[model samples]
Target chain A: MSSINSSGEPAAVRVVGGWASPFVNRVVVALKLKGVVHEMLQETVGKKSELLLRSNPVHKKIPVLLHHGKPIAESLIIVEYIDEVWASNGAPAILPRDPHGRAVERFWAQYIDDKIPPGIRVLRGSVAQDKDKAAGEMSTALQHLEEAFVECSQGKQYFGGDNIGYLDIALGSFLGWIKAVEKIAGVELLNEAKVPNLAAWADRFCAHPAVVDVVPDADRLVEFTVQHAALLRAVNVPK
Target chain B: MSSINSSGEPAAVRVVGGWASPFVNRVVVALKLKGVVHEMLQETVGKKSELLLRSNPVHKKIPVLLHHGKPIAESLIIVEYIDEVWASNGAPAILPRDPHGRAVERFWAQYIDDKIPPGIRVLRGSVAQDKDKAAGEMSTALQHLEEAFVECSQGKQYFGGDNIGYLDIALGSFLGWIKAVEKIAGVELLNEAKVPNLAAWADRFCAHPAVVDVVPDADRLVEFTVQHAALLRAVNVPK
Candidate 1:
């Protein structure tokens, strides 16, 4: 096994992430949970730097973590890399030790990551002529998500239970977005009556210290969204 | 470290995958790389049985690996899980230890995975007007992909290097579909002259033993495409 650095610090971890992107937040949560201190560089979707572009030439998107000038892209991939490097005994690892249990958590995280984006897509396209069609699609996706949460949360506090693990970090990033999406779309995905467990899970997830600490300013996020909403409306992009 | 069980196997691992899915193939490649003996169940997509449905009720998708009856869903997630569990000391892992390298590879994988489908979307839409728009969208996406390949390869043998790794495995799954897409759409994303490195990479990928041994029957896939091509054409789909 590799020895921990004498300085008790990871080798200069730096994160290039946007304030409003839940995708970026997943990585932040992982870094925090693993107790890895990183230099957080604020970025925006529209304005990418040469460093960001060069570091991640293919995607050229934020949530690019530069560890000693080496970059890792994609939020979940970064999380996995974090787990592998910071394998401190008894420290909060992002993955479950049991392979099966780990897989279960991973399955739910992927489900939520893939499906939940459509609701935001719907909200982005709200003013379109086919808004109803997108809404229906978003609604079905949310229904599936609600079902997913019920199965995932059965007999567990977090997705891996007790301490917040991979799934919690994965889903926790979206809690802020869920409220924003609901307000923007005028549709409640996680209604108290419709999905009590998920609603509760969201509450517990937001309350996690690791999550609460790293999330961007909620008011700022709302302002960003309001600005973005206008931009979408002007372009008639339908998201 | 855990002791290897009798017969030198770490433990019994099984993959629930569909023959038609690239997602499932990602896990298959990882298992082969690690030299883990496991069972492979060929599942029918969109027509899953109770076992699969129950195993992954949230996503209800295949590429669910049951290690000692514990299910892991999502292809990339399964790949990571496989790497974590069956990883050999000093042996190749799908992701790089270096953060930046890992990030770049992951970002492209996610970008290609998310963006490439949109190109296919234009081919899949039924409207007459939609077909032309889809072609244009697809062309632009391919342009980005070709340019990305030129930038990312930087003369590296594989996305990870020398041997196939995560990014190669991720993109390799799409090659089988690309030819069919090109034939049907009458548009070439990877011409020999246009994308020599990518074209060469695809060739090297297909001929790899791990990729060749377990890949679904190409002839059968082409036959399926042949039969379905007319139907897709009738709808003015990509075919």
Candidate 2:
């Protein structure tokens, strides 16, 4: 943790996050890369802790990184804040120096944030006849995602080439949920046959030391999904 | 106007944008500020122009600024790109230079971006008996917003203080839309009696030379809303 100042103030980054949240994982990976130390508080979402409630009064969502009492909500925003505050030496810059490169990265990150949620909607919609429609939408979204990776990466190992960047973090959060949806729906969105580059990128990302250490256990995630998938499906089914 | 590059190419930053989009207006303001010369192309949303479709196939959204043949999409991302590329000597930096100041600015900007749309939901839920319910939600949102602005500006004239930064530009594009909604909805969200600082801030932002020059014409916007409000109302009406 070279980022810590000599005064031993702990560099003051406390993440109010949940255990199963992939969004929280993105922030965790970023903090780890920055060599910053902080307490990680696992929040109960439906019954938000009083501290979480006070820290993020507006959204009341998890992954709120409270730095010295001021909370920064939204996982991506917190990641950027970590990068700015820690000023890591020789660590991967989450954004590119080239203006164009930065835009491309942010563009994909925003797209994933906005559009990929529809796939989650569809995944939740599975098990009803309406599930079929949601499944179709998910398929289309995955196809578009495949095309995006093919175009953006060209031949690079990551969105930023050789090393993962913001887009990688943004997109990587989906892998666990996506895999769970694939199992629940009996379909595969990230078939290597269709999106080899994205699949490879996912592999490289999962292998990264920072990512490997922080990601929630895959077997536990799968078991949890298997338990909860039924209720989620029932709720999303049109009455 | 001081940002003419050494290439002597009509300062040739190219913009792929659409009319009638607030996101595109963000880029337009930044370019006008730096006096950067740019070639503009209007690209459609559902059916993009060949150039845009090819250049920004990943997101397939407009407001992609091309500099030296590279494309940058998403509005905020483009704003940052423009700021980085065209920032002249002694001109106000769109983003704050101090890490803490930057973090605070970004926090509110993200807050506004995430939460303000729901505040405008009053415009949507007007016809139903639950219209009052929607208005209540709007009021709560506004109250939160009042606190946010107080915290954001404190004694400063702008989020960046005295100088219009990214937060101002980001919020400015929406002020016209908010005013338009207020008129049709017959409710004032930013009444001076309630949100005096924010109301004054909005007034100052609209009067800023860069903002005044680049914002869409009020009359045209009013006319556009008159024709479109009916369609919006129909979309939001309860079944």
Candidate 3:
């Protein structure tokens, strides 16, 4: 785990997020990594607060970071905001310094953001979600990420090298969801045999101090998935 | 116009792009704004180049920027890359200087990136595209952008305020396709009467020298769309 550089002002930073959300976890863990003390405003699913709606008028989604008076929505964007606001607050840098390195981070973060949970949603999703295609995409994306791990990690501890950086926080936040999905799907995405490095990386990432509390417990997620699937089955009558 | 601080060497910059792509237009225009001359390696729709396949193996898509032999894929990410590498090169900044302002730029640029063409795609799309939902979303999103234009522009000419910034390049690149889709669908998405400010902004944005050569001609796009639609109609027979 990277040591905290400077203790940020706790009162100044706040996150409107749900406890179970991997998206929300990205913002939260990023803040913690920066040593920024923040308050979490728990948001319930299916109901958006005035703060969220105003903060993100377009999507009205959770994980809106309210710094001082302004609201920044979207998890990855919010994490980038945290990195910039505290660029020098001295906790290890979230983004790399060089332009190319930064762009590479953005690319992979985007890849994870766009592909995932959507990629794994099929395990818990209704019949309409297309399990075959989602499974195929997940399989391919995992292989790519496995190769990316070899390249980005460079035999270091994390995507950020010796410490956690942007891609780490980006994909690390989803570890619980991935685990739950794997359990539900009866598949090994980050398999020890197939993606040994990624599987090992997931273990190291989850054990990090910055991550432990932010990411939901995999077992809890599994329970939630089962219940959610049951509820969906009840609600979704055959067309 | 933001004067170029340095004439970045043309030899170092090469773009793998297709002529008719709005995504490609964004990267091209951003480089132009930076006063960086570049070579365009044209790519056909059906065939993927060895260069492209090598550079962006995952999706194998175009609009990959090759700088000093390194590859950067995805248009918005490439534009951000351009902004970062040439940050001091005297181009009007694509992203803003302050963290909050930069976040705002990223938020809206993403809003534009995520919404558009997808929002408007229904107009030029096949049967599966939900016209009503898309049209409704477009109507709402345009209103949001219209309002955002007022806020971001602050009575100035562009989203970047006085000079074209990230959001301007992100959205402006699509004007050609927007016009073509309008011509095909007989709809006014950027309606002057409805969104006077955005409508006016679009006209002004297209006239910018950086944009003129890059964005494909609206009439040409219209011709392409007509041909493409006819081809699709012929191929997809009561599947």
Candidate 4:
């Protein structure tokens, strides 16, 4: 840990993240859950900051955590790093203490990362042909996630049992996006009839005080989607 | 850990892997490095086994480590699980003991996973248009990896300082494929002048006892690539 700055704040803790990115939101939720005091630096998409590029030269992506002048990239990796560094800081454990349990959590978190992007593309696609094809792919991805929730949750409020854990934070950050996508695509992704447990889980996750404070405003995110509709269409041209 | 079978062997330690898969090879190298007595269950690429599907229902992917009848999927995650479970079995540490060092190792291992597949696609592309585009993408990816070696290795014999570690196992498993791809594409990917450190790193990695024992024979891998050339070309068609 680095010493406090002249302003009497933790000098080492800083995060470069985008306003509407689920990946960035994951990191923000983790930091708040861990009770770490940090400054958030906003980086816009299509125009990344020099700091972000320098910090993450390989990917030049956001959600890079700068701790004591060192940068760590990738959202899940950053969350895991936060968990390990702040393990003794009196916060709830993000990952289970046991090795096997931790492995299970990691498996699901990776699963979410693997599956969600296709769904996002489907929602953002302006062409009917692309949207239909992506819808089928996204459906299969969501079905797998639903099965995972049933198996891993075991009827608990969160994947970490009583408290929200790694997979919860990983997937929970997407609730607002899921809503925005549903509106844009005119389709339901997590309907109560189709994925009841996951629907409840999303509601509970979004309602958490720590998460609520950090997540982007839903109406603004929806508005952001509409504002960027043409850009999304151009990026998601039928393939 | 589970009890031994009637033969007094660790009956539960088994890996479902494919001979030609770099992902599968990563798991094999880790098992051998940790000195874990495990059985290797071979799987064909297109014709996946029922056992593999049953073990890993979510992904249905190979390199699933079956420990005590429990299945763990995804190569990197499985390697981490093996490291943690066998930590006390007198094997070399796969990840650095310090949290920050471990994070750095994880980041690069992930970088390799994210970047190498696209390079492989470029090498396998049959169409000139696709190949030309893929070549530029592959070059950029390789350059980033070259820089990574310079930054992380620091003139050491391995990324793990004096010995092999997580990133070493993760990237080293692709050695045979790299050789085969270079031959197939008629291009140099890791030449001494281009990426000297990584070139030396690859040579050291391939010569290591653990890696040598598990990596598929170089000649056989080249033959495999030749046999599957059409399939590879079809899959790599500009997507």
Compare the candidates by lDDT and give the number of the best one. Answer: 3
In candidate 2 chain B, what residue range of length 10 has the lowest lDDT sum?
A: B230-239
Model 4 C-alpha lDDT per residue in residues B60-100, reported as the tens digit of each score: 77778888888888899999998998999888899988777
- lDDT tens digits, residue span A71-113, model 3: 8887888888888888887688888888889888899888987
Clashing pairs in 2: B1-B34, B1-B35
lDDT tens readout by residue for model 3, B1-239: 22222675445788988777888889999999999878888876556789999999876787899997899988889999999999898778888888888788788888877777675556676455877677677767888889988988889999889999988998898888778767777767888888899999999999899988888877987776666665544432101
Colliding residue pairs in candidate 1:
A70-B100, A71-B99, A71-B100, A72-B99, A72-B100, A72-B103, A73-B103, B123-B238
After superposition, candidate 2 runs with Cα above 4 Å error: A1-11, A124-129, A150-154, A226-239, B1-11, B42-55, B58-61, B115-139, B227-239
DockQ of each: 0.45, 0.59, 0.79, 0.75
Candidate 4 colliding pairs: none
- DockQ value of candidate 1: 0.45
Q: Worst 10-residue stretch by lDDT in candidate 4 chain A? A: A230-239
lDDT of 1 at A227: 73
State the lDDT of candidate 1 residue by residue for A1-239, as single tens digits: 12235786644788887667788888888877877767777764456788888877756766788887677777777887888788875577677787666766766666766666655655655355455565566566556656656666566877656677787777678777667666666666667786677778888877777888666544555566677766545532211
Q: What TM-score does each of the candidates earn?
A: 0.75, 0.84, 0.90, 0.91
Interface RMSD over true interface Cα atoms for each candidate: 2.9, 1.6, 0.8, 1.0
Chain B alone vs. reference chain B, TM-score for every model:
0.80, 0.79, 0.89, 0.88
Those runs of model 4 whose alpha carbons end farther than 4 Å from true positions after fitting are: A1-5, A8-10, A126-129, A230-239, B1-10, B125-129, B230-239
lDDT of each: 0.68, 0.69, 0.80, 0.78
| Residue B204 lDDT, candidate 1, scale 0-100 | 84
